[model samples]
Target: MDVDNGMLLCPTHDALFDKGFISFNDDGSIYISNKIDKREYELLNINKDIKLNFKREQLPYIKWHRENEVQ
Candidate 1:
């Protein structure tokens, strides 16, 4: 939703991002593992530390939710 990144989110599972350029399925769901790639991996490592910091800044809202939730 910000100006820096172009990411798409799945409502069902807010943990996943459509960074692979794939849209939602007919059932309105997405499987991220099937879309993982070198760029995503690199982005993960690069963003891991940041994701650990200010989680709300991450694209996937579920990540922030999980990061804030108490187990």
Candidate 2:
């Protein structure tokens, strides 16, 4: 993970983003549950409202469908 930019880089799968923080679910699925600071939230809101693709560069983690892997 790139600590400076808060970009998470999973080696087992592809999933990256500039989130304030993150947590994993029981099913091994990653969910964005970051609580942004007031100032940060404002900026994020602006980006979201403008439909900016922040996660565009990140590949989604699609491991559930793999028959050998079970979370």
Candidate 3:
């Protein structure tokens, strides 16, 4: 795996991401899976307002995750 193919996320967010509960749009906007309950958003401290400052080189990896890993 490439070193650039990684993101720095907290444990909770990391787990959620690993499980395909979250992703990101090309613009870096957070994309929560439909499978996640609305109520759990508050408990998980995640919201639609979250965004990432990602490099252009990371887009390919992000795209792969969105297309293959996200729910």
Best candidate per TM-score, number? 3
TM-score per candidate: 0.21, 0.21, 0.93
- In the predicted model 2, the residue pairs found to clash are none
Best model number under lDDT: 3
* Cα-based lDDT at residue 6, candidate 2: 28
Tens-place lDDT per residue, model 1, 1-71, is 56423343335223344233223222324323434574774554323222222233343544433344313
Clashing pairs in 1: none
- Counting clashing residue pairs in each candidate, in order, gives 0, 0, 0
| Off by more than 4 A, model 1 | 1-20, 31-71
Candidate 2 lDDT tens digits, 1-71: 63222233443223213232333333434443334354664443323222212332232322222222222
What number of backbone clashes does candidate 1 have, counting pairs of residues 3 or more apart or in separate chains?
0
Descending-lDDT candidate ranking = 3, 1, 2
> Model 3 segments beyond 4 Å from truth?
none
**What TM-score does structure 2 among the candidates reach?**
0.21
Weakest ten-residue segment in model 1 by summed lDDT: 46-55
